[model samples]
Structures are given as structure tokens and as C-alpha cells.
Target: MTTYSTGGEAVVEALKTHGLTTVFGLPGVQNDWLYNAFYDARDRFRVIHTRHEQGAGYMALGHTLATGKPSVCNVVPGPGALNAGAALATAYGLNAKMLFLTGQIPQKMIGREMGTLHEVPDQPGTLRSLTKHYDRITHPAEAGAKIAAAVRAMNTGRPRPAALEVPMDVLQQRAPIPAQAPVSEPEEEPVDAEGIDRAVSVLAGARRPMIFVANGAQDVPEEVTRLAELLQAPVVGYRTGRGIVDSRHPLSCFLPEARPLWDETDVIIALGASARSALQGWGKGGRSLIRIDVDNTVHGRYGQPEVAITGRLESHLPLFIAELEKKGIRGEDLAEVMPAIHADWKERSSVLDQQIRYLAVIREALGEDGIFVDELTQIGFASRILLPVHRPRTFLSTGYMGTLGYGFPTALGAKVAKPDTRVLSVTGDGGFMFAATELATAVQHGIGLVTVLFNNSQYGNVQQMQRDLYGGKVIATDLQNPDFERFVTSFGAHYGRASSPEELAPRLEEAFESGLPAVVEVVVGDMISVDRFR
Candidate 1:
């Protein structure tokens, strides 16, 4: 079947064929036709109009992070794209599967620099640098193939953001689009049998081994757990990899607990994650390292590993387990040692009592399968190593980007993706205000997200650093915050206040039960810094 369609309509049709109907974006004149296409297909799509372009981008990120599926975000070119730049950078950093669509100036206005509406000097260059794949749609006929190609690109290799720019005039142009064809994903590269045998040889002979996981291993939790149990090696996760192995699993360990074990281990199996921090911080002397990742670049990121397998974890892990089984290898059981290590880490981490207390309360309110979006705050810092994650994708972080003010908007997106699952955003005074206006977006769209605002009346982290490093002299760290009660209520959201963790428990419960956009303000003074741990 063939149909005459505008470029915008063609793009929508292509995306729909690819099973993407939810779009997060703020409409503008440059992309008016795209919005029109969206409106016509309203019954087939869920259009989330956000307060800002960044909110749209972040929400798209949250959707993908929670579901491990590709997400879409659309914005106008120039200012709109620039507004969403931070989120795009963060997406790139986290290797998120996101499709970024934007409207360019008129088709003939390319590189003319006439000060036209939403014109940027080098929009294409900027986008290409930010995403793994980028292209432009010049006519309606090109929309389907280009959109399909973009979707395919993000899904393949190391999953990252992809971009497509359609000029305003092109969006209005009409052309014949053929029936959408299935967008076939690229085939996984053959697993390296030689690499797998070498890795297994090292694993099979090791008395003590450690398994480190990151986002790459997120999908193969069972395989990772099976391997860990078979080897009796503790599975350690930090940041994005935290919940790959359940915390209740005897083999599960956090970075803090794994430090001592790192020195004792004879071999390390790094899956879908680079143990970069461990090598840089703890030193990797007297240890043979095996790195398995889809991206070959990661194989030599820090230094060459003893064995590097460049293929999907889904492919390589099973091969490794099968090869080890053939060898009948069994590793030392550290079931008893893990508990002792965790207890020691607990006593050592008591300096972060306040953050831990608040995290515990929020965890209680979130129940078993809820998601927690973290910010670049004191509590957020503690969460990286201290929080107990029971399931994969339950914990969301900004990864290496360390983005501030991403918590609230990201949580809103998570709630949008999984409406039945409770989602909580933890932010501090400074970071919360960055995308604070999104509270309106949440309330208006009926996104029930429980945000725990830690109000310290300042940039707590910077102030603490200033005091500790610069002899108590602080500048511009103190904030004159609005009455949070009024601020939240003004947006027609439920508001609760707490002075301590005990008070926060009931407030969190109330916020979750309300089933509305809610904010729980937890007031605190100067907090103990978790910077040293990092």
C-alpha cells in the first residue's frame, strides 16, 4: 500500500511501524507540521507535551531507562535543541536508546546565516557530535527510510541516542510513501570462541574471582547470577550496574564491600562494564582481567585486558558458562564471607547516616518493584554505593554525566513508562530548581511521581567542599528558597514536609497514597560528605 503524505506524517508513520507511539516534546513554529501529524494520529499515540525541551528529552531518557526500550523526543531546532542539549549529552554518556527529532529552518536556508527563526550556525555538526547516528530528511519520501535507519542505529552496537532533522519546508512537502517495511536490526557479530576459551581457562583455574557488572549486563541478570553462583565469585555493581544481581543474593556486593575482595581475587570478569574505577582507585596488580563488551572501544578503554570478547553479553555470557561447564570448573564459595564484608562496609559507611536514613524511608515507601531516580545531591551520592537495589532498572542515575536537576523530570518520565509502578525522585535544593517548572507538566499530565526534596537552603555539596578545601569561605552556595509548601501547592500538587527521616516516612507514604504529583520536603543542615568514598 502506498499513500501521499507530508514529511511529518511520513516520519510519524515510520515511527509507528517501528512500534514507537509515545513522544515527549514541546511544540514550536519550526515543527508545527510535525505537531499537526501528531494531532491527526492522536488516537494512535501518547503525546506528552512538557514544560521545557529539556524536560521532554529527560523524560524520554527516563522512559528508556525504566523499560530498556527505545524512546523518542522531538523539539524545534536552535534554541529548543539547545535547551535539550544537557539531556542529550547525558543520554550519550549513559548510552541510552533515544531518538531525537528536531525541525530545521526552511529547506533553502541551510548555512546561509540569514538570522532566520531558530537558526544555528552548525546544527548538523552539533547533533552529530552528541549522538551515535545523525541525518537530515529533505523530503517526505526520505522520512521513512531515514527514521527506520536512525531507529536501527540506536538499537545496534552500543545503544546510544540518534538524531534526525527535518526542515520546516520539508515537513510541509508531500510525497508518496510506500507501505512501511520491517526495520531489521543488524545481526550480532559472531562470538569470539578463542576469547571465550581463554577467559574460561583463567576462570576455571582461579580460586577466587570477582564479577563486575554495568548497564551492559543489565539484561542478563540470570546468566550473570548463574555464573556468579557457579564460580562462587561475588557480583559487584556500582552506579548503573547496581541491581543486575539482587542485593539479597549471597553473591551480591557493592563497590565498598568489594574493595578488599578485589585485592584477594586472582581473576576479574568484567561484563558489559569497564572496571575503570577499580583499576584506577584500587590498582589491578597481580590480577588477570577479562573484559566482555559489545563495543570494541571499551576493550582497551583503560588498558588492554588479558582477554577481550567483543560481542553482545547475551551471546558471550552463555558461551562462557557453557565452556566452563564443559571444563567442570567450580569456584570457591564465599557465601559466608560476603555477609561479613557487608557488615564491615555498613559500619564504615555510618558517616552517611542522614542520607542512608532518608534513602531507607523512601525505599520502604517505594515497595519492591518501584523505581528510584537519583540526582547529584548528598543523598544521591550516598545512593550510588549504599542503596539496596532488588531488581534491574529499578535504580536510575545520570552515570558519568553527573547531571544535576535530572531527578524530578526523569522520575516523571519513569512514571509515564510504568504508571502502576511507584517512582521516586530524590533531589536537593540546588538541583531540584533546575527543572522545577516540570511540576506543572506532571500535574497537568497526571504523572503521579513522588519527589523527595532535600532542602538544605544551598548547594550543599559545593558549600561543603568550599568549607573543607578553602577554609570555610563560601560564595553563592546559600540559596533563598521559596516556601516549598506554597511552591508545590501552587502547581496543584500534594505537598508534605519533614524535618527528619522518621517524619519523612509518613510523608512519603502519604505522597505515594495520594496518587497525585507530590513533593516531600526534608529539611536538613550541613550533611556529612560522601565525596571521599568516590
Candidate 2:
């Protein structure tokens, strides 16, 4: 069935076919026709208009990170696209599934550099650099195919962002909709038998094995847990990889807690984890490495693994477990010794007393199912090792990108994805100001995101670095912030204040109880830095 429709209508249809009903975007003249189409189909779609392009991009990223499903982000040309570049780059680093849509100058005006509206020297080049797949829809007839191709690019292969650029003229033009079926996400690759055999041979003989997991292993928590139990190996995750195996599990360990064990381990199973710092920084200590991942390029990228299996862990782990079962091979369970290790770790990490105390309050308030978004703040730094994440995707970080100011907006998107679950963003005074305007977006959309703003009135991390490393000379680190209560209340959002962890707990409880977009400000003085642990 073919029907005449505008390019914008075709693009929206392509997105709807993929079951993407929500769009995080900021409309402009270049995307006027697209917004018009969105308005026409208002009942079928929910457009979360943002105050800035970066907010739109990060929110889309948050949605995907929380749900492990692709989301859409639409922006205007040139500056709009450039503003969202950081989020796109972060998405690329984190392997997020995001489809980026942007408008171009008039098709005829492109490449001529006629000083036209929203023109840049080479916009397509920018998009190509940030995304794994990018294309331009030259005509109205190409809109559907281009959008569909972008979706396929994101869903298949190494799960990165994809982009498409459409000219305003093309968006306004009408053409017959092509008869095309919706693209299905490709299946995870089958296991490599030879690779699996080599891995099993190494694992069956090893007395002490360890498992390291990252974002790639997030979906196969049960499989990873089973494999870890079979080997009686401790599973360790850092940052974005947290909660793959519940922190409460005896076999589960945080990055810092696994450091001492790394010395005793003879074999390591790097499951969908880069283990870059462990292999490169910590030195392997002659451990036999076995890596299982979907991206084959990681085989020798960090260090040459003794055995490398390229496939999804969900497909490869069961085979390893079955092979170990056949051999009747099982390592000593660490449950008996884990309690002592946990106590020692707690005593050793007391240097971070303030951070741990604050985090405890937050953890209690957030509960088990809530999502916690981390920022590049001092507390956020400690959280990588100090926080106990009980479920997958419950802790969202910027991965290796270490992006600042992504927490609040990303938390909004997480709340949008799981409205019934509590979502909290932990940010510093300096970082929260970046996307603070998104408070309006939350209030207007009724997002119900609760933000915990740690107000030290300075970029605490940078100041500490400057004082310790640069001989007590600090510049451009001190921040003069507004009265947070007034600032938040002015936007018609709820606000609470706390000066200590004891006070923060009740404040957070009240904020959550309100069931509205709220900001809880925590006032603190200078505290110890956690850089040594990192």
C-alpha cells in the first residue's frame, strides 16, 4: 500500500515502524515541516521538546542506556547539530543505540557555501566523524530508506549511534511512500566452536579464575552469573558495567575490591569488557586471558588474549558452562572468605568517609529498582567503587568519556523510560548548572525526576588537582551559584536542602514522596578526594 506523503511524514512513519514513539528534540525553522508532521500525529507520538540541543541528545542517550532500546533525537542544522556533538560522542563511546536526525540547508545550496541560514563549511563531515553510520536524503523519495538504513546501522554490528541529514526543501516535498517492511534487529552471532573449545580448555584447568564484565555483558546477567558460579570466580564491574552481577552476590566484586584478587588469579575471563586499565595499567601478572565479545577488534586491542571468542556472551557463556559441567570441574567457592574481604575493604576505604556516608543515604532513598545517574563530581568518583548497584542499568555513567553535566538531563530521560521507578541524578554545583534549564522540561513534561545537587560552590575535583599537583594555585575553579532553593522554586519545581547525610535522607524521602520534578541541595565543605583509588 503506497500513499503520497511529505518527506517529514515518511521519516516519522519510518520511526514509528521501529516502535520509537518518543522523540527528544528542539525544533527550529530548518525542521519546521518535521515538527508540523509531529503535530499532525500528536496522538501517536510524544515529542519532548528541550531547552537546548545537548539536553535533547543526552536525554535520548539516557532512554537507550536505561532500556537498552534505540531512541530518536532530532535537531536543526549546523549549530544545533554541533551542540549535540558531545552527547553523540559519549553515545559512541558507550555503545548506545541512538538515531540522530538533523536538517540541512536547501539541497541546492549545499557545498556552495552561499552564507545561507544555518550553513557550515562541511556539516556532513561532522556527522560522519561522530557516528558509525551517516547518510543524506537527497530527495523526498529517499527519506524512508535513509531513515530505515540508519536504524539498521544502530541495531546491528557494534551498537553505536547513526545519523541522517535531510534538507528543509526535501522535508517539505511530497512523494509516494515506498512499500517497505520494517527492519528487524539482527540476531546475535552464533558461537565459534574452535574459539569456545580453546576457552573451555583453559577454564577447565584453571584453579583460580576471575570474570570481568562491561556494557556488552549487561543483557546476559543470568548467564554471566551462572558461569561465574560454575568457576566460583568473583565477577567485577566498573562504572557503566556495574550491576551486571548484583553487588550483594558473594561472587560479585567492585573494581577496587578485586585489585588484591587480581594478583592471585591465574586465569581471567574478560566478558564483553575492555579491561583496558587492568591489562595496560595494572600489568597482567602472567595471567592467561580469555576474551568473549561481539566486537572481534578487541581481541588484540589491549593485550593479546590467550583465547578470544567473538560472539554475544548470551550465546557463548552457556557453552562454556556446559563444557565445565561435562568435565566435573569447579573451583572453590569464595562465599566463606568474602565476608572478611568485605570487612577489610570497608576499613580500607574509610578515607572516603564523607562520600560513603552521603552515598549510603542516597542508596537508601533510591532503593533497589531506582536508577542513579552519575556526574564527574567527587561523590560520583567515589560511587564507581563505593556504591552497591543491585540491578542492571540501575547505575548510568558516562563510561570512558567522563562527560560532565550529563547527570540531570540523563536522569530525566531515565525517569521517562521508567516512570514508576525512582530516578535520581547526583551532580555537583558546577556540573548541575550545565543542563539546569532542563528543570523546566521536566516540570512541563511531568517527568518526576529527583536530582541531588551537591553544592560545594566550586569545581572540587579541579581545585584539588590544582592545589595538590599545581602547587596550591587554583584558577577558574571557584563557582558563584544562585540560591538553589530560589532558583529551583522559580522554575515551579520542588526544592529541599540538607547540610548532612542524616538530613539528606529525610529530604530525599520527602522529594520522592512529592512525585514531582525536584532538586535536593546538599551543602558541604572541603572533603578528601578519591583520585588515588581511581
Candidate 3:
């Protein structure tokens, strides 16, 4: 049976087939047909209208991160596409699966440069640089297949963002609507026997073996935990690696405590994580490294690994854990060592009275199940070590991209995805202003998001850099912030202020309990600077 449909209708059907029930986008003239298609099927699809294209992209990313599924973000051609670049790049850096759909000029006038509205000389090429895969729909009939291909690319192997562009005329044209079905991800590659043997041998021989888990291994929490328990290895998580293991576990250690152990440990098992700067080039010199990753290109990029297992952690970790048990290798429990390490960190962290106090309040306020979205702030950098995350995907950040202005929008998306769960966006004064307009989006949708704005009136990170490196000669870092109370209230949301550390907890508690979109601004002075984890 054949059915006639416009390219826009085909896209809507494809999204439904892909199990996408919600999408984030802003309707515009160039993409009116697609919006019309969505309007016709509004009962079946929930479209979140964002204030900006960047917000739409971040919302898609937040939804995907929370649910472990891909979502769509639709934007007009050229400028809107460019505006979405930051969130798309952040998604790429975080290895998130997102489908970015954009409107393109009519196929007939695509490259003629006849001043068509919303035209870019090479739109697809620009998007190619930002996404894992890029495709353009030239005809209405191709929409379903191209969308399927994009979804496949998003789900297979190491997931990343993918983009598709549809021309205006093509979206309006009628063609046969192909039947679509759910796209299945490719099977995880079988664990290599030789690599497993090599890894097991190293673990068995080493007296002190440490496990370094990264965000890539987030899916295999059980396997990761079992492997750690079998070896009794101290596990260090960085970036997305947080909450892979319970922070309160006896063997769980953060980067600060694990840094010294890097020198003492005879063998290091690097799982689904890179030996990046955050690890301080751990695998470089004297340490023996056994690395397991889905991307083989990372092998030997930082340092040569004794065994490079090229397979998903979910597939290879269980095999390695079983082999370790077969060889009668068991790790010594670090029950005593872990407590002392945690105590020392606590004492040192206490020295930064204001920062630690603020973090403690927020941590207590959010409780165990609450989600924390961090932007690039002094508090954000500190929270990576101080905050305790207990579940996968609970802590969302810009990751390696270190993108500012990511917290609020991403938190909005997370709230949309997990409406029942408490979600908070923690940002600095400078970063908060970037996406502050999102308050309208939240209030309009009745998303009761609590934003904790740490207002120091400066780009604290860069200001500290100049002060330390250039003898206190600060340049363009100071900021004049708006009256947050008035700003948020204007959106019909509540607002509160805390000038000192003692006031934060109560204000945060009140704001969160209000069940409205709110901002709690904390005014910390220049004395609150970034402190290194010693």
C-alpha cells in the first residue's frame, strides 16, 4: 500500500516510529510546514517551544541525557542553526545522542546565492563540523530513510549528535510515505579473548590496582561495581564517571585522593575514560595501563597501554571480571584507607568556608534523588570534587567543552524529561545572564525549576587567572548584574536573595518548596576565588 504525504509529515511519522514522544523547537517561517505537521499531530507529539535555538538544542540534550534516548531539535536555516552550535557542540563533547533538524532553502535556489531568506552558502557543511553525521533531504520521499539513518547513527557505537536538513519546497511536496519502524542499535562487539587475558594478567600480578572509570562506562554500573569489588580496587570517577559507583562505597575515591595513589599503584585499569588532563596524564610514565574503550583511536594517543581492549565496557567488563575470579585473584579491601582519605579531603574542603557551606546547603536541599546541572563556575569546578552524586545521569555538566550558560537550559530540559524529580541549575552571575530569558519558557510551561545563582559580579575563573598570572591586573571580567528578585518576579516567578553563607540554606529551601520557577541569588564577594585541590 502506498500513501501520499509531504516531507514534513514523513519527518513527524519517522520521529514517532523512533519512539520520540517529545521534541524541543522554535517555530519560524522557513520551517512553517514542519510546524504545521507537528500541529496536526499535536495530540501525539509534545513540542516544547523554547525562547532561543540554543535552548532548544540544550533541552533536547537534557532530555536525552536523563532518559538515555535521543530527542529532536528543530531550527530554521543559517542563523538559527548557528545559534544552536553551542549546545550541539556540548552534546558532541558529552557523546550524547541528539537529532538536530533544520530548514534549508528550496532545492532549486539552494546554492544560487539569490538572497533567499535564511540562506547560508553551505549549511550542511557547517552542520557536518558540529554533528557526528549530516544529511539533507532533497525530495519528500527521502525524508523517512534519511531520518532513519540519522537515528541509527545516533544509537550505534559511541552515540553523538546527528543533523538533517530539509528544503522548504521539498517539505511541501507530496510523495509516497514510506512505512517506518524502530531502528535497532548495532550489537556490541564481542570481547577479545587475548585482550582480556592480558588485562587479567596485569590485575592478578599487581598488588595495588586502581580502576579509573569514565563517562563512557556509565551504562554498565553493575559490571563496573562487580569488577571493583572483585579486585577491591579503589575506583576514581571523573566528568560523567561520577555516580557510577556509590560515593559512600568503601573503595570509592575522588580525583584529589586518587591523585597520590596513581604513583603507588602498580597497575591502572582505565575503563571507558580517556587519560586526559583531568587525570593529569596518568598513564604517561611509570604506571602500567590497561585501557578498555569503544573508540580504538584513543589507544596509545596519551600513553601506550599494556592491553587495549576495543569493545564496549558492558561487553568486556563482565568477561574480565569472570576471568579475574577464575584466576583466583582478589583485591585487598581499602576499608581503612578510604575513610582517612575522605576525612583529609573534608578537613581541607572546610577551609573554603563559603564555597563548602553553599555546596552543603544545596546538596542537603536537593537530597539524594535530585539532579544538579553545573555551568563553568568557581563553584562548579569545586563541586566536581566536593559534591557527591549517587546515580547515573544525575549530575549534568558541559563536560570537556566547559561551556558556560549551559546549566539553566539543560536543567529546564531535565525538568521536562523528569517532571517529578527535583532539578536545580547552579550557575554564576555571568553565566546565568546568558540563558536568563529561559525564565519565560519555564513559567509558560509551568516548569518549577530552582536556579541557584552564585553572583560574585565577575567572571571569577578568568579574573582569578589574571590576578594570579599577571599581578592582579584584571581586564574585562567585572559584571553588573540585574536585580534578580525583580527579574524573576517579572516572569511571574518567585525570587530571593542571600548576601551571606548563613542565608543560603533557608532561601533555597523556601524557593524550592514554593513549587514555582524561581531564582535564589547568593551574593558572594571577590574573596570567593577558585581553590586548587591539593
Between prediction 1 and prediction 3, the one with superior lDDT is 1
TM-score of 2: 0.98
Instruction: Score residue 249 of candidate 3 by CA lDDT.
Output: 81
Better of 1 and 2 by lDDT: 1
- Pick the lDDT winner: 1
TM-score each candidate: 0.98, 0.98, 0.96
Q: Candidate 2 — which residues are off by over 4 angstroms?
A: none
What would the per-residue lDDT of candidate 2 be over residues 1-534, giving only the tens digit for each residue? 888989888888878888889999999998998998999989999999999999999999999999999988899999999999899999999999989899999999999978999999899899888899999987767777777788888877678999899899988999998865678667667778888889888877798898889999889999999888888999989997899999998888888888778778999889999988677768887899999988899989988899988887777888888888888889887877678778778888999999999999999998998899999998888899999999999999999998899888888888989999999999999999999999999999999999999999999999988999999999999999999999999989999999999999999999999988999999988889877765
**Quality of model 1 by C-alpha lDDT:** 0.90
Task: Flag regions of model 1 displaced more than 4 Å.
Answer: none
Considering TM-score, which of the candidate structures 2 and 3 is the better prediction for this target? 2
Model 3, CA-based lDDT: 0.84
Deviation (Å) of 60 in candidate 3? 1.4
Query: Model 2 Cα displacement at 247 (Å)?
Result: 0.3
For residues 385-439, what per-residue lDDT tens digits would candidate 1 score against the true structure? 8888999999999998988888888889999999999999999999999999999
The window of 10 residues in a row where model 2 has the poorest summed lDDT is: 179-188
Residue-level lDDT for 26 in candidate 3: 92
Go through the candidates in order and give the C-alpha RMSD of each one to the true structure. Answer: 1.0, 1.1, 1.6
Tell me the tens digit of each residue's lDDT in model 3 across 384-409: 77788888788887888988898899
